[model samples]
Target: MTSAIPRITRRLVALLCLVAAPAAFADIVIGQVAPFTGPQAVTGKAMRAGAKLWLDEVNARGGIRGQKIKYVFRDDAQKPEETVRLVKEMIEQENPAAMIGTVGTSNLEALKQDGVLEKTRVSMFGAVSGATSIITARNMYPVKASYREEVERLFKQLGEMGRTKVGVVYQDDGLGRDALAGAQASAKTYGITLVAQSGYARNTTEVSNAVAEMVKQAPDVIFLAATTAAAIEFTSRYQAAGGRAGLFGMSIIDVQALLTKLGPDRARGFAFSVVLPTDDRQDREVVREYLRLRQNSKDTELSSRSLEGFIAARALTKAIERTASPTAANITETMDRGFETDVGGHRLTFGKGQTPSRYVDFAVLGNGGRLVR
Candidate 1:
């Protein structure tokens, strides 16, 4: 009987040890919600490619803290309602350590409802700048230059060119409104007047009428604040209407597809603020690495949209690496410490009260649809 009792005790102890052993920690999951299947699908696709490239590289190099990163993409369809639902679902089910690469102002704004960042305590980074509200959130970080900063820089360049009177055309959405507001405010500081301001819906395709209306004003410069597709259509029609005013576009329009669609003759002399460094082979180590990655990628023709995604992912990765743990509060604290990273030759910094990407790059559409900085 004593021998049987001793064997039973040993078996029970072994079972308890097995039950108490810690489970292996899985890879860190980063959730990305963007307009993957809507009007901005091109941008979404580019962003996804860039992110994937970065993730592949990171994994190849043994991911941060010896843990792999798993990026889960959610399609918001560029709709505010869908964005809200998708974000909620991701937070509840996946419980990702952080969220990155949310595109568009409306979608970002929708994600801001009910102090979601504070409640979930998840770090959100890499929002394509549209509204200042997103970056202002303590927990949210922006990887791109703000529309306000871009507009201010454009206005400064216009002022230098002696082009004072500017006309503005924007979609009547949160993005356009924020850009127009920024332009208007910056114009005041530069002693420039926005001669005409026109608004249109995103669903509207024919902007010839709007172009004509803007041309009638005869402003020295036209500031376009619309999506890439609308910007292309508007620019084509505006030029076709024989409007000679210099055209300036925001980051939203600073895409390769628009330049390709408008062609060199139409796109020439067109200037826009670029949040990321263009595909300049001689820029920085980061750009070189990015190009190398793209060359190895099956998909050629890497666009600025994808570059934005790559920048965002890198920023998030840096934050995660610096963080003590994958917890939201620790990640936010690490980001708030203002670590610097090189996005191509451009420098990006994040901290409290400091907007990301203080310096903005200006690109001119040159011959052969090339972007010259």
Candidate 2:
């Protein structure tokens, strides 16, 4: 009888070991792809900093379900082809539980087409705003408001001020077309007229001809929808051309960069919608963490891209905690129900039937190139 008892106890121990094996080896991996080098390098640096802050916080909290999260970051250089390559590499190599905080629409669009999210059963969170095409897929979750929303908001404000004639300058791409369509639609609703519209090719720093054409129309306001470098050059030259029309911009343009390039005097009174609050450094923990991270960061200036990255990481952390599993399928399921996180004062939400972020706060360029909410 004693020998029988020892054999029974040994069997029980073996069962316990088998039950604990999966849990012992569990790990959660999250991927981030951004332009670590290129024209948008400043934006990418800020995003990396913001994502690191959130990941550090999550790790300090004992990690998700006792499994530490490994953040695998890759630089896509802001090119769609490079982004696709990097994302494919991450999936093949790291097999991250999910990809979070992809920094551009072009990259997100490519990933969507590649069916990365569907194959991995993971959500792409915190992507930069563009047309609704990216998030139309069930797997892609965007954390920032669309360019369409920005155009609508700007047009609504202009209509309130009784500005009926508007001019638009955009880059010739999917993003630019989205902005132009939104602006045109909004203007039509308000009975405002679109006096002129022009486009420049992507990565073209010179927009003199496009700006000159739009200025020739003499509209009440000129909408500048382009990359930071192009927008800066257009605004500088547009003002130089003695065009007094009020300058408006989409969320893609780095407000700080605009101010830096145009200076406070030239940038004053310029209006744009912000996905996150810049001036509010209140009792928010995220804000405190961001400020701390910024202090140590070589890039001192804050932009919408930085806030987008921080917010995306927060959402990813929430999804991890909610799932409490280190599997991609489980985490993606949690994300479909959506999650909420604070981007400064603004609350960012993502969920079913919600293709893009609806949270947007309006801000104007204040003195000394500051974004005042």
Candidate 3:
């Protein structure tokens, strides 16, 4: 009788609390996996902040069909094994309608191999990779230009700028391999011989040897196929040694963040391929909206990476709004309908015989760390 009386009292308290909770948004949820506590944590934080900014605005507008957007996040630390386990755990337990912000190619590939994507029916949205995973998977979506496109455009852009001798410093991994494939094709097409090429293991700061090799060939533009941090280290050492290569980086390289790390002396005069327009670009209403939202953010500092995250979240939200409920099937169908959507001038449309975005832009860092458009 004593136990029964206490249980009855607990039930009454739960009912009262439920009655008091907000009802306007209490159903929708987004799940994310990222390198929140690793070498990539800086970028992970930026991406999360950007996603939260858009989500907060959406919820303030009463959410999608009055269902509040709740986010569940797990840190993969950019490891493939950990990513596989965590993704499996979420699919079996969390019941998220769609998974967004999963970082790295291996992480996403691990999830697909675990068979959790189909088992849970949780579509992947706005993942960080522009590799083959995006197009090969039935439910995954890409927000940035592919490495292939980035490399090809880099060659064309360099050619346009009258730069023929290109050198590549790439990390030895899937990311680098994909980038190299594209660069080789571009070199063949452009009829330009690669001035020099070298590969280093990921996370290694010992690039003096590679830098020396590249300096001998005197590449007009040094295309970086390495990770962001690795690229910074190489560029820093290379430039300090009086290497005059026009330091070029891929879309995956965060040029702004790289500048912040290297300071004005090392970062100035560097150019990088980007998938999004510059922050100051205001020709598109979508661009203006992003600037406004970013200005209203608490951090006030934004990067191309963060802006891409914002655009991706905003794009997915539009698709979710078309669904009757936050179910994977409904979300997938809505997204596949090929509806024209402008993500701050990064247009995304996919329907019968259509595809997702493949736009590429360019930016160069000038004196005092200013991004010269």
Candidate 4:
């Protein structure tokens, strides 16, 4: 009787362990490498927050296919070399099912230098860069408007407003070069003259010379293809020097960051293109959902950057759900086979269009740092 009792107790313990074990099924790991501790930290933080929001909701709802999703990220500190190393490390150790929201044009170029994605067969979704090189890559699927499209839109608006003379300030790197080319092409399309152009070194904000040059030209508007910090500096200096040209910037500029640094009074009228709807756009279902989730969480900062991250996660989540088996190849194949999802009235399509998302809007800093459409 004692032996029988011990056997029954052992069987009950085994059953409980099987029921309670969290790791019975492997997690679907996704990797991200972005600048978390460098000049681009502000953008990286928002991207992380946005992606985590949707992913948390998914995990709370029992995840996809009964397997929880695990997000693994590393800070590249805005260095291209570090980006490569960290991505390689994550693949070898974590074996991420896919990569999401890797930031920077130079970093993407570095990854492409050695055919990293091609050799590894890992597909990256929602890269933060709009450079032609990164967007046109074989395995990369972008979820935002390209720099060229952004420039064209800006120029088209300029043409409508009769602002013909335009100056371009670009970073002397892959990102800026790509945008400059786009700006040049858009200039021709919109009948705007390339009055004055200047290049600043990457990862640095020495824009005084560029400011002086642009102000000297006194163009109708200045198209900034620079980073957030650079944009703020250029705006502040340009305005202080009595330069009255409207400052139009790429989507890379974070409106929140600009307002924080320059304040509402200084930031007012500084316009920039946004690849996604602004946080205040509650008319869209995705915006409302994102705002609700953000309010429920500890994240307090709301900007287009974070919103973009949420949309990117939503797209990746849909891809994962659609795949019968969540391997890198399976996810990529599923996305390649004409994948599209309605993210609360905003549509993101892959394999059916030249770009994944055709949504682009513009906003300017209004009173008290508010985004005015």
In model 3, where do residues sit more than 4 Å from their true spots?
1-25, 203-206, 300-302, 336-338, 351-355
- Per model, how many backbone clashes are there? 0, 0, 2, 0
Question: Can you write out model 2's per-residue Cα lDDT over 1-373, one digit (the tens) per residue?
Answer: 8889989999999998978776645667888888878777767777776777677767778877677778889998888888888888998898888887676666777887888678778777776655777656667776667777777888888899999999889878777877888988999888889998889876567687887787689998888888787878888888888888888777777777777677899999888776554536557666776677656656553454576677678777777767756578988788677766554555666677574466566777887767677
Q: Tens-digit lDDT track for model 3 on 316-357? A: 897887777677767877765558777666788654323466
lDDT of 1 by residue, 1-373 (tens): 8889989999999888767742224678888888767567777778777888898899899888677888898888788788778888998888788888777777777777656767777878777764787767666777777788888888888888889999999988888898989988899988899899988786355577679888899999889888877888888888878898888888776457876786677788888887766667455777788889988889753577777778778877877778767666678778767778765566787877567776687878888867687
Model 1, global lDDT: 0.78
TM-score for model 2?
0.87
The TM-score between candidate 3 and the true structure equals 0.87
The list of candidate 4 runs beyond 4 A from truth reads 1-24, 300-302
Against the unseen true structure, what C-alpha lDDT does each candidate score?
0.78, 0.75, 0.76, 0.86
Listed in order, each prediction's TM-score against the native is: 0.89, 0.87, 0.87, 0.92
Q: Residue 360 lDDT in model 2? A: 66
Positional deviation of residue 221's Cα in model 4 after best superposition, in angstroms: 0.5
Candidate with the larger lDDT of 2 and 4: 4
Model 3: per-residue Cα lDDT at residue 37: 81
